[model samples]
Target: MARAYNFAPGPAALPESVLKQAQADMLEWGDAGASIVEMSHRGPEFMAVATRAEADLRTLLAVPDEYAVLFLQGGATTQQALIALNFAAPGDTVDYVVSGHWGRTALRQLTPAVAVNVAASGEADGFRTIPARETWRLTPGAAYVHITANETIHGVEFRPAWGAPAPDTGDVPLFADFSSSIASEPIDISRYGLIYAGAQKNLGPVGLSVVVVRRDLLERAGQPRADIFNYASHLANDSMLNTPPTWNWYLAGLVFRWMLDQGGTSEFDRRSDEKAGLLYAAIDGSGGFYRNDVAHEVRSRMNVPFFLTDPALDADFLAGAREAGLIGLKGHRVLGGMRASIYNAMPVEGVRALVAYMQDFQQRRG
Candidate 1:
């Protein structure tokens, strides 16, 4: 069967070309006589793969020389907990601006080793909007100010319409969770002290994540932790202090090459806007049949969550979507509706197909 237009969130659709390359390399990689995944992490073959992935990513994001990039095992959540352990000491305050579910999750990962000050939160607005930057109550000597660059589930992002793409934190450095939005556009990496993302969303496959941090931050005498949990140690060992996720790292390298060939982040930026515009227009034009409660200005360009006029129609909607060669439209249980996660891998044609399906569904069931 042909691949349907997938709209699932993380571990989302990968570029067909990347998958095909992986397929070709699966049984044997290069002249190494073993699969890339079967090779030792410290061996030349896998090391070259890991090294190129980071270099290509740096080029793709225009990462600065002062920043160190590490491709580590686990998802963004692991890094969330590690951030405090590596950057903040006991009693050091860390300010957080919670915009959505993942933002709240970031707070949960912290140990009592550090004090947390929630500078701003959109929960009061049901996460339909991001609180204004001016209203934030930043701490005087916080380790860093944290923000979720985009909320994959809540369908909210720090769009230009909201304010600066990266909020100003003054003397305190800015750290952002770009798990679902990384590589979707050109970002001024200098504005952020640290940027991290799970590879599953826009980068590549699952079980791997990327962390880019200023070298100075790695010098901080963070709280006591194992070398394995230390960012500096990970950097010292080139993110191979332990057994790395070789397969995921290799696949991510292929994706970085693909993105660069396809015109890097700028091209994806245009494609994302076009795809999201088409999808949102269909929802906004659906009369009362479809609704996205997110404030228009802050609606996510990556994840678009919308509700049906009748919640009862959700099952039929999903069923019909599957029959129409579309899937992964079911929304998270927190807010039962539907979400179309149009990450970098989702083409404009897919969004067009989705829009057509929505219009047809409305005509039949509205």
Candidate 2:
């Protein structure tokens, strides 16, 4: 059977070439007489893998020297509580931007510990729009201001506007949950104090969450830190404070190499823009047969959610898409419709195939 194009939000599609390389190296990696998964994290061979992965990622994103890239075990969800635990004391407040389901979920985990101030919210509008940065009610002396740069569930993105100076948050740092949009575009690493992303979406496989944090922020995380979740501990031991996920780390290294081969983040941004444009154009030209609710300015290039005018044909449409080798087009259960997650690994040809399928489906159904 032929492989279908996968569009799942997290644990999404990976490049075919990367998978082929992994397969070839699975039993014997670089003539080491052992698989990467069998090697100890502290060994010279594995250390080289870790080092090269970090170097490639740093070059790809232009990560500053002041920031430490931590290959952590926890998913992005773990960072929510960990961030609160590390930064905010029992009575300290943190500013959160409520964008969509993931952002709200992050707040829920943090609320049990810290005082959360909703700096800006698009909840009232059903998360169809992103609140302007000027409208955020940032708390004075807040621990940090957090935003989900792209909300996967809502298909909303917060792109930095050109020629705009950074927002004045006094001494409070900016932390972004860039899980869905990490390598999908080029981000100015200097502008954010902490950026965390689950590797499953655009970077690599699951079980690894990459955290790029300014060194100063780790030093400033008040004492009485949890042993496992402490950023300082991970930094002090070079992400090997405990046994790391060796296999995930190895695969992540491959993904970093793949991204570099594909022309880095700038190329990713261009490809994502082109893919999104094709799909969005299809929806717009559908003559009310398909509708996308996300506001124009903040539309996500990674996840595109749309609803069919005739809800009764939803199942048929999805079944037809699957039959045509365009899989994972069904939207989240909470938002009953269709979502096409075109991550960095998804080829432009895949998006074009999807668009053609949608057009053919719409015409036949109509």
Q: List ranges where model 2 is wrong by over 4 Å.
A: 162-170
Report, for every candidate in turn, its global Cα lDDT versus the true structure: 0.94, 0.87
lDDT at position 64, candidate 1: 95
Clashing pairs in 2: none
What TM-score would each prediction reach against the true structure? 0.99, 0.97
- Worst lDDT run of 10 residues, candidate 2, spans 159-168
RMSD of every prediction: 0.8, 1.6
lDDT, candidate 1, at 348? 94
